[model samples]
Target: MNKAEIIVALDVPNAEAMEAKLQEMPDFIEWYKVGLEIFCAEGPAVLEPLKRRNKKIFLDLKLHDIPRTVGNAVKTAAAHGVNLMTVHAIGGRAMLEEAAKAAAKCENPPKLVAVTTLTSLSQEDFVDLGISRTVSEQAVELGRLCMASGIDGMVTSAHEAKALREAFPDALLVVPGIRMPEGDVGDQKRVASPSFAVEQGATHLVIGRPILQAEDPSAAATAMLNDMNK
Candidate 1:
């Protein structure tokens, strides 16, 4: 159960749904992510069962706010014993720095990851929002700012992983928007196979629907692990 094998995105609607998935999860997968949906639905209580199972938890709340607020939020997340968490680089340097500082003080700090442009967003989407740069460009710039603020890692698409690895060799690149060869891309505009993501230097892969929607989730997760190792 190496950290890189798989990170199941617990994107279910509530704790009950997550528990149902957990019952079917394979032992090979050692990590699980609690995203906004579940976190908002079940709150911190959702994490208790996963912890009881000895699974490393990644709280993906994607916190974004003013400096003081975000900082306090990071501290609170750390107290919950989550292994990883995310903030928005778009939240600006002050907030990022504040979060970083808060994480640093935690006795066992959760890895602070920053969200760049989401995989669901395309260059056209950015254009529609009056952001003139391409999606890749914006992601890279945001990655830089996150690094400068001293955060542990970032959440980006596999499409940008190689370039980002080159630019920030020491920073962890936790990627989402992963699709298996036979999997559907769904709403994600930027995606890569598990093997491709690993070869490109991604430290972690966040997978949701492909595993969750599979007829056999544990087997699907195992297959994804095999693909990543290949």
Candidate 2:
């Protein structure tokens, strides 16, 4: 079985808050996801501390733009020495292809993954947006497009991990919206337990609030890793 990795989400407001969370986490916590909130607040300067500590980064900006613009952005992110980054699969084939090419050209490229669907949305949400397909169908469709466009992985809800795994066995399926069985779901609509996601072949599990909001963040992260291993 593949060893599932845990990426603690640093969803803080500023660099100070991010640094505090980092201090609370255990050494075994190898990867940290620097999402929109903190990244936008602190910019690339925030990542320097993580690099100094030798921790891996998952830069989840979910880049969505025109081909040339997205490609340039990828080059810039790669220069920051991130281990992984995300783009929107909904951006279509040409944009994904360009992002892939940009990464390939970089000397120390970040592995690119595409976001399928946000876990916050439901079928009703899709209908409101005039998206005709169901959530599962949309994830698969976009995932297929990503592979063909040469992107390496996908950021999807754990609910869709099994289907994506069966469809693309070797593809990196990074699952977010993971909550412990006794934990609150918060804003996520399709959350699942860590064990369930790992069983479904999720390679990396992105957990934010459960660990970040715990009374003891390190204990919370350790418990989450235990759940994944179980």
Candidate 3:
């Protein structure tokens, strides 16, 4: 059977821990997300094996910096053979445009995906950060800015997926912070089921923990794929 359009997060402490989970992953699970923790721990060298095995990579460093700095970072990420890399849309249009331009120069440029509001935040959380915009309004605004800046993909909460998809019809909305129905939410304040996101027009799903922490990782992944198929 075709696997679900899911990207499993390899959020372990180090390359060794990620390697252990790699062996347990179902064959149909071809894409992997190497986020800030593991990437910082092991560096791009850690993803070399995944590339050798031909697995697609989503390098989620959530780059947020000045235009020149973010641009330089994108060049390096693309050179590492990542299929997707993230920048924060909150960094504004100039930086987004610069990162896009940098990626355009790579021999095998990774798709530039800008991050909207993180899913771990709530309305209360926004107020704490001194922002008045509701989470949904902020996400949509950032997504619009990213699109207007020429980035085609965005990393956003599944809670915002339907509205984001509506606002940016052609975007590759990579919804993170996914949770199974009635599953433990961990630190994510905004979450959604895989089926609900699919129904709402999310182009991809970035799921961590739920599958990785399951007793039988392969079975958990397979079950998630089955769930997505429904």
Q: Candidates 1 and 3: which is better by lDDT?
A: 1
In the order shown, what is each candidate's alpha-carbon RMSD? 1.6, 0.8, 1.9
How does model 2 score by TM-score? Answer: 0.98
Q: Residue 230 of candidate 2: its Cα lDDT?
A: 84
**Predicted structure with the largest TM-score when compared to the true one:** 2
Model 3 weakest 10-residue run by lDDT: 1-10
Greater TM-score among 1 and 2 belongs to 2
lDDT of each: 0.89, 0.94, 0.87
Which regions of candidate 3 are displaced past 4 Å?
A: 1-4
Q: Tens-digit lDDT track for model 2 on 28-121?
A: 9999999999898999999998999999999999999999999999999989999999999999999999999999999998899999999999
Give the local distance difference test score of model 2.
0.94
> What C-alpha lDDT, on a 0 to 100 scale, does residue 124 get in candidate 3?
93
Give me the candidate number with maximum lDDT: 2
Tell me the tens digit of each residue's lDDT in model 3 across 1-230.
Answer: 12238999998999889989999998888889999898888888998979988999999899999999999999988888999989999999899999989998899988988888888889998888999988888988888899889897788887787788899878888888888897899998888888887877787889889989999989888877777779
Cα-based TM-score, every candidate: 0.96, 0.98, 0.96
Instruction: Give the clashing pairs for model 3.
Output: none
